[model samples]
Target: MIRFENVSVTYDGAAEATVQGVDFEVPEGELVLLVGPSGVGKSTVLGAVSGLVPHFTGGTLRGRVTVAGRDTRTHKPRELADVVGTVGQDPLSHFVTDTVEDELAYGMESLGLAPDVMRRRVEETLDLLGLADLRDRPISTLSGGQQQRVAIGSVLTPHPRVLVLDEPTSALDPAAAEEVLAVLQRLVHDLGTTVLMAEHRLERVVQYADQVALLPSPGAAPVLGTPADIMAVSPVYPPVVDLGRLAGWAPLPLTVRDARRRAGDLRERLGGQDGTPEVSVVTTAPPQPEAPPTSRLRLRRKARSAPTTAPPAEVHALAVRRERVQALRHVDLTVAPGETIALMGRNGAGKSTLLSALVGLVEPAAGSVRVGGAVPHRTAPPELVRRVGLVPQEPRDLLYADTVAAECAAADRDAGAAPGTCRALVTELLPGVTDDIHPRDLSEGQRLALALAVVLAARPPLLLLDEPTRGLDYAAKARLVAVLRGLAAQGHAIVLATHDVELAAELVHRVVLLADGEVIADGPTADVVVASPSFAPQVTKILAPQKWLTVAQVREALA
Candidate 1:
């Protein structure tokens, strides 16, 4: 029901079109997934469907885009609201009301639907998305994942024929992401709703797509095919696909069940004589003395040995209360220098709150938090900068400067580092970001890189990141993994709260699982994740009864 005929879009600013010669069509009642690396104009394609391209974003539309027989060029977003629903990358920008229930109903009200119909749809969406309990909660008070659900629910209540979504599950936990994807499936299968979604987390959404559209690189025309076909040749793919390619399977598998079915022989090849897969061991030495402070942050690969220094961060029976909710309770943890930990759980499991407590963003109701041997909440900002730094879930929270250049300069000043130190980090992490561009104009992934660079400039002994890979693609994520691994080798303690299980599988040395504000599972990465059904990566699931955590491990073993 959506068609793009020779579509090309160029913003008002400078050079060429962001997307060129893009032509595709979505059959009625089908879900099409748009896949590509970061900064490939996937968002631009999605925006075009909902009439946000040139209409609201001030770009030039070279070709025609029609949805359900309505031309987006002639029909502005407001005029096409009846038939199209759009959800952008950031959920906070979508809300127009205070409470969850109100936000869900706002779209229906805008369409002038009858009060009874609106109420019915609102209740249905709330139940579908599992937001019934959060109906009365303020949007600002909800967690990032919760806000994302509300944003999706708001668009869904209108019952639009065509849905355009950008990273619908980026902020959601695994189970929550499944629920959202299932909802989209039902909408397409049972109700004849058409969906066009662009997402970086292909592991969560690729298998569910009816067809796939791949934008190979920046300003490249899209190529369309079946999920399996596209994944076979696409530069970006999930772990299961990587495993399939490694094992030389005839057809690549998209789902765990399919991969598991084809994994019998491969499993035998990698299995030990006892019929169990050989376990991979990761060891770190006891803490050593603290290293001398450096002039500026630099990426260097040191030996993967833990230092014998004192722990950089210590949390003892930490209890944190936000408003009336006890966000965290009786949590005790320690991070030795040159160690990396992944804090993971479902939404509102207190992972973010725990990070906040470490950074002194939230005060503990009971117990204590220490970073670099100093009480976090009691330390001054200037002193704290040298001890700990946090890149929050909302990367924009740490960004305040008008331009990229100004932000880097400010980071250097705040961190007491050499000039251009932060700029160098930004260049390494996210290349091609000009100094003149505003932080607000950067893509979600670009903004995140800048925020991380700003924090890394200080070279704090303890580093904390929340959902670090939210918008990063595979290449960018690889760069991040390398950079973080280098930091850990340099005696920096890194703890990241994330829902990206693949990231946990590939980067972290340890996995700490939290639930209901309490630590439930804490151990080595392979030990913790391989044991959990919900948290296991695709490779682990496919090669079950085996201890494999990543495709790279499997590749190394086979080689």
Candidate 2:
């Protein structure tokens, strides 16, 4: 029920179209997944469906885009609201109401639906998205993932014929993502609703798509085919597909079940005495630099030799209360020099709250938190800068300068570092980003890199990141992994709050699972994740009984 004919979009001042000659068709009742690297116009393509591209975004639209036989050019977003529902990447920007229940009912109210029907639809959406318990909570008090679900439910309550979503599951935990995706599946199969979604996390959604549309690169026409056909040649793919390709499996598997079905012989080949790989593969470390050791490197060497060195960060009986919500409860944790830890759990879990506690953003209601031998809550901002740093979930919150160059310069002054140190970190994390670009103009992943660069410029002993890979594609994520791994080896203790299990599997030395503001599981990465189906990475699930956590590990073992 959606068609794009000879489409191309160019912003007001740009030289070339962001997307050129893009043409595709989505049949009614089907879910079409738009796949591509960041900045390849996946968001732009999704915008065209809801008429946000040229209409509200101040861009020139070429050719035609029709949804449910209504031309988007003729019908503005408001006019098409009856048949189309769109959720952009930033859910906070999508809300007009204060509470969860109000937000879910706002769209129907705008559509002039009967009050009874609106109430019924709102309740259905709340139950469908697992937001029933949060119906009375204010939107401002909810977590990032909770806000995302509320945004989705707001759109879904209108009962539109078409759903256009951008990174719908980016903020959700594994189980919550599955619930949202399953709801979309039910819409497509039972209700004949159409869904067009663009996402960077292919592993979570690729197996559920009815068809796939690939935008290979910037300015390239989309390639449309079945999921398997697109994944085989597509530059970006999930870890399961990566494993299938590595194993030379014909007709690459899209799901863990399919991969496991074909993995019997391969499993035997890599199996060792204790149901683990014979050679333990180290996938997180980057190659050592050849340059002379810097002061930070020397400090790392000293810490390694000095076993009595204090941990970078320590927490005991930490409890944090936000209004009536007990965000964290009697949690205890520790971070050593040169160690990387992943804080993981379902949405509304205490992961972000714990990071906030360590960074001194939130004062602990009970117990104590110390970073670099000083109580975090009582430490001065200037003094804290030397001991710890934080890159928050919304990367934009850390950025304020007009240009990338200015931001780097400001970071250098703030951290008392060398002039080019921050820029150098940006270059390593995100290459080819020019200095003149505005922080607002960059893509989500690019902004995240800039924020990370600013935090790393200080050369703090303890580093904390929240959802660092939200907008990154596989290639960009690899660059991030390399940078983070290098930092961990240089005496920087890193703690990241994330829901990306693949990232946790590949980068973290330990996994700490939290639920309801309490730690539920804490142990080595493999020991913790391999035992939990919801938290295991694709490779670990595919090669069950083997403690492999990544495709690189499997490839290394086979070699």
lDDT of 2: 0.86
TM for candidate 1 is 0.94
Off by over 4 Å in 2: 278-309
Question: Model 1, 1-559: lDDT tens per residue?
Answer: 9999999998877487889989999999999999998888999999999998889889799989999999999999998999999999999999889999999999988888999999999999999999998898888778899999999999999999999999989989999999999999999999999999999889889998999999998888999999999999999999988899999986888889989898888888886433443444336743443432321222121222222234688999999988867889899999887889999999989999998888777899999898777786786665555566788887888788899999899777766578999999998898777898889878898899999998887677788999999989888898899889878877788999999999999989899999989999999988899899999999889887878888988888788
The TM-score values for the models, in the order shown, are 0.94, 0.93
**lDDT of each residue in 95-202, candidate 2, tens digit only:** 998999999999999889999999899889989999999999999999999999999999999889999999999999999999999999999999999999999999
Q: Report every candidate's CA lDDT.
A: 0.86, 0.86
Model 2 TM-score on a 0 to 1 scale: 0.93
Clashes of 2: 0
Error in Å for residue 212 of model 1: 0.9
